[model samples]
Target: MTSTLDDALKRLEMAVGLLEASVSRRLEAENRRGDLETELQLMQDDRARLAVELDSALTRLHRFEAATDDVSRRVRQAIGAVQSVLVQAGQLEPEEG
Candidate 1:
């Protein structure tokens, strides 16, 4: 009877130890999950910010390209006017394609 009681107590202790180890593992997993979630949120926020910055850069680039095109057109028109005046003054011969 005494041996049976000791065996039962030992089994109970082993069971408690196993339970504690399982709970510890679960708590550690939960903590790691929380950390990963926070990091993922930060990454998502950074991605959004980068997307906005990229869009702004593209918009500015488009405006600059449009301005460059306008300048080029105006320069071409001025050159054509100068060529016409020179031709009328007999200072330059007419160009042939």
Candidate 2:
């Protein structure tokens, strides 16, 4: 009977140890999850800031490209008109330098 009681006590002690280990692991996991949530919030804020910057830069780039196109068109027209004038004056022969 004493041997049986000792065995039962030993089993109870092991069960208590297992329970304690399980609770510790659960607490650690909860702490890790909270830290991850904070990190995720920070990342979301950074993404929003970057998105605004990208949109502004794209708008500026588009404006610059439009201005460049306008200037190119004007330059081509001016060159065409100058060529016509030179031909009328016979000073710009296509056969000579």
**What TM-score against the true fold does each predicted structure earn?**
0.87, 0.69
Per-residue lDDT of model 2, residues 1-97, tens digit only: 9999999999999999999999999999999999999999999999999999999999999999999999999999998788878888997765344
Best by TM-score: 1
Candidate 1 CA-lDDT value: 0.99
lDDT at 77, model 2: 100
Write down the lDDT of every candidate, Cα atoms only: 0.99, 0.95
Give the Å shift of residue 79 in candidate 2. 0.9
Q: Give the distance in Å from residue 81's predicted Cα in candidate 2 to where it truly belongs.
A: 2.8
Tens digits of per-residue lDDT for model 1 on 1-97? 9999999999999999999999999999999999999999999999999999999999999999999999999999999999999999999999996
* Model 1 alpha-carbon drift over 4 Å, by segment: none
Task: In angstroms, give how far residue 92 of model 1 lies from its true place.
Answer: 1.6
